[model samples]
Target: MQIMRPLYVDPAVPGMAFTYVMATGGGVAQADRYRQDLVCGPGTQALFTTQAATKVYRMEHDYATQRVHLTAGEGAYVEYLPDAVIPFAGSRFHQSSVVTADETATVVYAETVTGGRLARGERHEYTVFTSDLEIRRPDGTLLAVDTMRLRPEDVGGVTGPGVFAGHDHVASVHVVSTRRPAQEIADTLHRSLADADVLHGTSVLPEACGAWTRILGHEQPCVTAAVHTAWDAVRRLLLGHPAPDLRKQ
Candidate 1:
């Protein structure tokens, strides 16, 4: 535990939520960051988020890495929704997550990123951002496999008509709920964002198949608003109330 990290959370919320960074492998880091930990108890509702965009600075020796562990209790719902991560040039980082969910649990989680503040001449031309994610049931069996990367030459990023669609700031929302029809929820979300002055799209997958939504636009404001709109609509229909915990500052 040589690497010191900042871990934050607000248990006073409607449910339980936390985020922090802790030492992982024996790798020597040129610097440190705040890691996150999030969870929920039976029948409890929780939302977890980062205070701001997590920045991984350049490393001259070895790779800086993070591992996240998440769980949701029976009849509980949780969201670890974090904003985009901006990596500076030459920075190397690896992120991985293992999420376990009970049969009665429901979750909506997402992670996104931008190249950088291009307006101010900031760009992550030669930087590398990598995240490997997996979802599992209570028994520890696998449910999904996701490998994501952001680089100048990597096609490992999102694509296709249902994916990024040429937008810079992109998001992937994974909702696990059976209380309501996923298709109906996505339909209403699309209709809600139709008139907005933004370019975006949404999709609904099968029950065991998690759903995905892609929003592409220039400004983060528009993209963030559109995502919130969808999250809000789905929350009311499924959780019996808007996600008060997911609201942004």
Candidate 2:
């Protein structure tokens, strides 16, 4: 893993630093184990993103796993918005993310996953793809937990009514913050995607701490646009500013 030097690209928020994380191997291979820990000190404002989409290559034997732990200190504002993850045929992978935040901190986290290489007509051909996410307070109090297990060979398959619902791409955004009322945050998220081209839903987080939204669509562009809309809404509500263009290549 390589982290680029901090860049001040957002004139609206001059104090916020933007950093990009790059994978030296370009993609994840079979039998790979990766871990990442990110800590934002008190009163700091930062955003971290990946240089490109995470591609999980086809596997034959063992599976790949990635673990991420994020901690936000008091009054810190941190965002981790990475690109989509594309699992090739026969790939098996699992990812676990744990977020620990102080009551006064604000953290925005998002993730996107595609069914497969849609251009190549590969859809849900992977053996298994699972992810677990947990949000907790600094004192170890659990706030929320989300788990996803996608196995095309399962009893009902991933395209079932309650699962992907035949969507090719899925994305989610979570905002953990005390800067605004939870219901207001949820409403903002909902309004952002009310007329969008994708299917989405928003709800307040546990304990009325913040809000979150989930988006699903057959096209990647539609889903990605909806995700960005939700994020921008939340940013405007909490930070009094809009989301900046990362200018990613």
lDDT of each: 0.64, 0.93
* Distance from true location, Cα of 55 in model 1, Å: 1.7
TM-score, one value per model: 0.76, 0.98
Model 2: ten consecutive residues of lowest lDDT: 223-232
List of clashing residue pairs for candidate 2:
none
C-alpha RMSD by candidate, in order: 5.2, 0.8
User: Residue 193 lDDT in model 1?
Assistant: 75
Tens-digit per-residue lDDT, 1-249, candidate 2: 889999998999999999998999969999999999999999989999998999999998999999989999999999999999999999999999999999999999999999998899899999999999999999999999988899999899998688899899999999999999999999999999999999888899999989999899989889878888888898899999899988875
For candidate 1, list the clashing residue pairs, or say none.
Answer: 19-36, 20-35, 20-36, 21-35
Candidate 1 has an lDDT of 0.64
lDDT at residue 242 of model 1 (Cα atoms): 62
> Model 2, 140: alpha-carbon shift in Å?
0.8
